[model samples]
Target: MVYQRARDQAELSAIQEAYHLVSKRMEGVPGLLGNELLRSAHDPSGLVVMSRWSDLAAFQAWEQGSEHRADTAPLRPYQDTRMEIPFGVYEVDAAY
Candidate 1:
């Protein structure tokens, strides 16, 4: 997940637009299951782009690839700088 913070409504709209464009660009990418854009109820400026992959290797492969930075550049400016690490990785340990 990548944390994002928009300074105001205009920036928030831009963030959402960028997220959708990125999502479209990522369609059919190998090992990418899907992704979602989430908003915080308490803090409307807060947002997250959470993506699911088939495995860690798949995600790492994409992250380290040449297109990674270019593909996500649109959203880089809004990354939550307040957090020491604005992103995280996790694997499913259990399922219902």
Candidate 2:
């Protein structure tokens, strides 16, 4: 997951735009299942990005690729923290 906080409204707009652009580019990428962009209800400036891939190798390859780096460059400054999981620590035992 990716987490970021914008300093102001303008920064938030930029952040959203950047993520949209990147998400658009991610379309048709092999092994990529889907992605979601979310904002915190309590903290409007906070954001979370989640991406689903077919497997760990697919995610790793994309993470190390130039496109991912380029796409995420604008977001580096606004990022407060990030968490990357290599394996499924928690599984969906029940999804209704």
Which prediction has the highest lDDT against the true structure? 1
Q: How accurate is candidate 2 locally (lDDT)?
A: 0.74
User: What's each prediction's TM-score?
Assistant: 0.95, 0.75
Residues 15-52, candidate 2, lDDT per residue (tens digit)?
88888887887898888898777888998877877777
Which candidate tops TM-score? 1
Q: Write the per-residue lDDT of candidate 1 for residues 1-96, one digit (tens) a residue.
A: 999999898999999999988888888878999999999899888899999999999999999999889888888999999889999899999999
Model 1 weakest lDDT span, ten residues long: 21-30
N/CA/C clash count, model 1: 0
